[model samples]
Target: MDEDRIMESERHQIEQIRELDLEELQVEEVENLHGSSDDDTSGRAYRDEFTFDAGLASLHTYLGEVEDTHHRLSFLDSGAILNLPLFYLEGVVLFPEATLPLRVIQPNLIRSVERAMSLVDVPYTIGVVRIYRDSFDGRLRFASVGTTAEIRQYRRLEDGSMNVVTRGLQRFRVRRRWIDVDGAPCGEIQIIQEDLPLRIPRDAFGTLPPLTSVSSPGPSHPTMSNTSHIKRQKCREGKNDFDADSEDSFESELSLKEMRLHQSAVESCYGCDTIDESTSSDDEKNVFESGGSQDSVTVGRSSQSNYQRNTSDALGVGRKAISQQSSHKQEKTRMDWIIMRQTRSHGVPRAFWPFWVYRMHDSYCLARKAADMWKTIVRAPSMDGFTRKPDILSFYIASKIPVSESTRQELLEIDGISYRLRREIELLENFDRVRCKNCQTVIARRSDMLVMSSEGPLGAYVNPYGYVHEIMTLYKANGLALIGHPVDEYSWFPGYAWTIANCATCERQMGWLFTATNKKLKPKYFWGIRCSQVADDMR
Candidate 1:
């Protein structure tokens, strides 16, 4: 009886996610600070995913065949400054290469879309900036750092609203913002030239023995012929073909002092680790501490990982090469590390590094590491294809990583690709739990997450009041209280009826519960937790 009771409780607790519902669920009534009780108005303001018109998807129709320095199509070919229609969304923090879908209903925004589409010289480009309310003051503030979105497709609705699909192109700094005469949000923005991916040259990096041999493509490890090198990893043993933990072999080869220097260098660049404990804010300290080991695959500890083994083997990096480093170096340190070269470079470009010093913080290494970690965390499409394009890989990971908006915003504001990739690697290493932002109550484990949309585990969707809400789907959650009765009205997930969900401890609205509206739907119920209200938590 007790066992049966426990199983029933687990099911009710949402510990198990039912099978996926492949059908599209159009829901509008998202309860938020912006939700309204008006039925007619709700239909226009809030919307869900819809099929896009294939004819309108061609970029050549709206834009000339102009290319930016990065090889991406852009309206501005030569100038650093671009005047674009700006969107200050409540919860959207777009990163480069990410896709943002919007249901435009407001007259001002609709006009802005039309204007962008109609322009001949620099058409279909809009600045997507994040606007958030201050917790202390409740005032709306716009982020200075934003991404330029290029409209890819659009369809006009009968009610005069438009469904738009936009892909982020570049990160820019807002120089000026104003409501145009047409009432659209417009900004004069300075395009921030992104730092190209940098890595320690192969000659400079020759001192270290290879861990995995599959070379990585890109500028990271250039050969004499300028051919790309392959890179792979060993994520410990299991599932995959390789069983060697190459990280173990790689770390043991480096001199103790060299490893320490590398660790310190990585910490300083990643932030908070080099932070003065006495002066650092509580939030900063908490973030660093949470990054500590919560599970076997920890940030600092050397644990059995199938990821490292598989990656190392594929790279053609042999265990023999890794074991040979001890012959050159005298001291063996207790610590195990995988990256960085020097403790300090004093703002010098990586390209200027003297050849004698070993280069460990190669952007490619970080990118490959991050991609491998991403694979281990979620069952998504492979990130191996991105390991070569470290810059895009960094942004792609930043866009889809299952964390809070504020964390994603921080990624958008970061300057260099290596720096951004390092930060993402750390976040993935420490990402484990979801907690209430206000009261810090544990809500769910990372393993409990579900991907309801192709965008990823977390996605931005609009509410009835034209506010974008970034919500993450989960099979089960704890310390949550369901508010109001379940209602299918304007449901976001078509087969699921949503019920308001709040943190039981603080009574703060966390997100919602979506119960399968149809009995045949695999997952009888699921939970949608607002990413804004959840925090990256420690175990």
Candidate 2:
């Protein structure tokens, strides 16, 4: 009986939707059609971990494959060019490691899917790109960089449409595009090279004492986690303890002037010479005197290039000349032996890459950086060290981070693992800088924002009659005033009443504020700001 009632209600709602034009339907009409004037939309906000984790795991597994596996399973060869079916989406950008759920209802889109499925070898692969609509002439423009979508699962509907789930496998740049006879857009594509983590050269700047020898310290830097700082220190100290016994006789002969020059060179390389004397620690001085302690180098994202450049220059006249050539050669040989043994022990193919490359791949370091990036995406108050493979972490951030489409697209185009991680770190660190669009006034920081939707801080929620509304949620705003009385009827969030919030200075409708009708609700009040209203370009 209950099922029958639900069916009847749904049938009635559909009839109402058909009678009233979708564009013309008012908010009251929508509520009446769905019989949801008393409905609380808040229940849908809570996320289930099982679904999220399963999806994440699938993506991780797909992207975590080795280079050879990716090659064997690839749908297209590197140089081979072919026209493939294209699907253009709005307000969405797909990354190579993400999965996109699509509904194919239009005749052209359905035909495109059918054509792709008819292929013998790789029946599921198709080209997916973003379409940007112009504000002036209202013309659609396709993005140059697009991803190849591999249809993982699909179901045909009675209406000849299909529901499909696809994973993004590789990035391709469009060479040319044309409409096919069936009205489906097809594109000739060139595959973009996959970005992998690079090996740090043992002598990155040839003959330069690695930055690890430098000693000048205080509190840990923001770019690296505290745990990494401690681990790096402990590892360096352990190595130094062994070297101390061997170097004791040689250390006694070194002049104080040479030691001072080495320390100065390290300081210059780290851009730490500007530090005040009062802030320098006695512990730091002791470490520098020991000549074995590795203390100063904390190469964060922004300073990686700088550290490389300065270290090359610092090598000049800093203990290298005075150190016996035979002793240096022995040390280099020992390092080579250790690297070779590691390569052989791992059974990594010698043909795959050079020994030094594998050493610099440094899985442990890359994993730590990936963990930090994950913490940023989830908006954790502090770093939560969840180790993930670097490639998986890159795709996770690219797919999950709640930034503007343009920012996400920029991340998609970036090619190196280290560079991509750095870019994500920069974006996450700067997520809060929100300003007004028209007058260039400071509005609200990301810290003050509260995400009330599953989609994220910014989300698109469609009404019962299929009207799409893009909404951004925030906790506070600087120059906005509320208009009209709070309405409890048909509130999106349960047990809350909403009032119109408009810019106090410009008087434009910014968004709304939802306050709990039930005093016991956890979030007493929250704001939903429109992305179109706020200025994201701080510059």
Candidate 3:
């Protein structure tokens, strides 16, 4: 019977595998089970153990095969040289996953791929590089860590570009970069052999009781059999007074009751049941009174027409007290709020002031200097305005920008500044012109423009033009929240849009209009006016 059962299980496993997609089948699965008997009594046990060892053995053998097959894999030693004659791209691959298709466009890269494909029967092994542009120097930089990609399929395009499929095998880091005699980029790279961190299993804690029930006391009373009628009457009166006063004097009385309960719990471990009964009665009475008093305060405050005059001062004091108590709960929570406030006051990093102040000082200083130069260029009148040429790009080129790619990328990415502003600034710097008569001196150049609605109550400004909708979509997709519904109207300039958005629940101004005039906006703008505000409140 056991033999029959094992045979049935083997058949079932095969059936399951047959039903799965080709891509879903891991390499170990295909190798170990491909020709296994469907009738062996010990097949299941044999397969598990066999597959485990087989998988590891296969991995080592596969690595060896890859190394022998691709010369690039051989070069991937502690210090292996790499040639990146064209665009570098970051690639990620899993061992059990299949290869991905790629298109090779650059001529030098094409030759490298062709050479590898011709040399190896498996046609695999190439480096992946992350592309970044330095902000200061406007030079391209690649991340050190990269994956080894193996070519799986190759197709030649009519234009000579090759379409290929490749799989990542291992990770490598660039150790040193150099230029070939012909000016092509090359680097010495090292294989990174660190294992991933072990993940601990999560411990499960059971659910907690509801806060309401936990805070309240159930019905319980203490009485002695020998108590006199008079004493009993006195106790009844006390209980009645407790119940009556509880509603009006709960907060103050509850504190005292809690203290008494703590002391009682500490004093008598043997008579815990009796002490608990007494403590519950006292606490219940105090809690009832406190709840009522709090309700009254809320009602009174709401009923007043002049909330500012009648309740602001009291609310302010109450808020301060609450905030102080909250601060005692967790340091991280307090720090988070502080950081949030700072972020709000400063604006997003590198986009606006105060917040931009926190950015790399050099970058901030450069941006500010650029802004000033732009202002001068825009305001200064050109001598013979028609013939004079502006030199805006020269300012950027002259700044001796840092070699950091991220900084240069940010400068290149800034938007919302008008071409007119750029041109005016350049003209001012080049030809010495003053501001046009129609434009105010206060009118900032495009990059320096603050696009925000006039401050007012929530819903005062409705973004009819759907600028806020677009901005919100871009910001939300990238995980951002804009606070404040100061005005109900929408404001749009050449490269910027503004509208007020407030948290629906708290009514606190969460942020101003979403700002996106960056690299992420192109596709969003192409989609045209989709109302982002109409989406569910993500907060």
Candidate 4:
């Protein structure tokens, strides 16, 4: 009976543990529920293989005669000169490529867009200028050859700007600009038409010395003349192939595919030390076995071997050239850095930007010279003073130095500034401290220190007491003014003045103060009283 009872107790404990475990799992699942929702919303899969049709399905009506010759011959004589006002902006565009969105913000351009849209038939004579230089003088210079852009979609903004998308059709040369002050820009442009030759020129196509008859027994070296001829032929052919159809394919489809394939091949080969040498041979053999002509067998094998050897030699030469170039570039960069450092150390401001560096250096030099002159005139305290220092000397000198906030900050950051400035600034700081202490003592002795309540601009009552505090003496001449009344009770502040206090000992101004108006604290009537000599003497 005891054993049976113990077994039942064990089963009851197991049941309780399972219940606790289930409750914990339920809580964990509840927490994960929110995470699962986020997972569902995030990391959307993108289509990996996307293709776009870039070729023109039909010949555009606006396009002129499609030339079918080589050398990109344009019928400049037959083409009409379309006058267009050009606004230039820097960006790249290829022929037969359509940019979807562009924002035009000029006033004349907006009018032009409106006029163009209002016409029953859209004008097909828009000229594009490749922006070269943007100047402060409001004049824009452009490249000689610019693509012709055809507006597809035009929209006007609330702010009188126009948004449009233009497809670049062809390139043109600007003949002349006729500026219409009241209307849009008008310019005579020569439309460049491409009519490249289909075959290589007779001069370039001269029988390449019959390629040294590759079948003949020789060193198996491709002759320089043959190579040169092939290279020239390729170049000439490339130039001749620059037609609209060729351009469209090259710009939009084939070039992109080539780039992608090249990138993939490079990435695949990355970090690979060895390539399978037998792969090319096996491929060639397979082709030969798969019904390749007997005449092509020897020629094909030699060509394949030659290609492989050439590729290896080229890669080796490229690596060596790259290493040499990298070493030269590093040396050049180091030399440039050293030159920059030396220039900076000599107190010459290093040229950072192309044009503005010299201007900045000139401004700094002028400011520094003025600061030096001002330092000579100002006398600061040598020892702790019982009486205040004279104020005019400090005020006059500090006012003369027109330093910017950044320059002042740099001045303040100087290590051992007091010693560096020959105790000039230190003395000035000490003078303010002494003056404030003396003022406090005098007010305390006279029982004139008053606590006044005033209403501020925000309709809040503030109670303030008169306690003299140290104010930087240099600030007084540095566009700092005091605001308050002259007599009774006043406060001294920077950049607003009411009453002035002069030192009795030196007959020089000391500091300013703001006094309560009509013996009552009012926000508007309260202003600062300034005294330069008194503040200096006290210091």
Worst ten-residue run, lDDT, model 1?
338-347
> For model 1, what is the error of residue 118's alpha carbon versus the real structure, in angstroms, after optimal superposition?
2.1
lDDT of 2 by residue, 409-459 (tens): 777877766667666666666675556555655556555545564434554
lDDT tens digits by residue: candidate 3, 290-375: 12231111111111234335344544465455444433333322222222222221111112222122222222223334455643
Task: State residue 135's C-alpha deviation in candidate 2, in Å.
Answer: 5.8
Task: List candidate 3 segments past 4 Å from native.
Answer: 1-87, 90-100, 119-123, 178-186, 196-539
Candidate 1 lDDT, 97-135, residue by residue in tens: 777767688899999988877666567778899987777
Per-residue lDDT of 384 in model 2: 33
For 1-539, candidate 4 gives per-residue lDDT tens digits of 12234334433443354454343211100111112222212212111111211112112211222322122212234244666655453322223232323455657766665554443422533565544223357354556665555666554556665556555555567788766775677567776544321111222223433111112222223344643453455455443323323422432321222322322332222112111222211122211111123211111222334444555555556545445544544333323322222222111111223222222222222233334443333322221221122122222222222221122222222232112233334333333222321232211000111111110000100011111111222211111132222332211221122343333333223333333343222221221112111122323
TM-score of each: 0.58, 0.52, 0.24, 0.26
Clashing pairs in 2: none
lDDT against true structure, model 1: 0.60
Scored by CA lDDT, what does every candidate get? 0.60, 0.52, 0.30, 0.31
Q: How would the candidate models be sorted by TM-score, starting from the highest?
A: 1, 2, 4, 3
Model 1: how far residue 155 lies from native, Å: 2.7
List candidate 1 stretches off by more than 4 Å: 1-79, 203-360, 536-539
What does the lDDT come to for candidate 2? 0.52
Best by TM-score: 1
Off by over 4 Å in 4: 1-80, 91-94, 115-124, 134-140, 157-160, 197-539
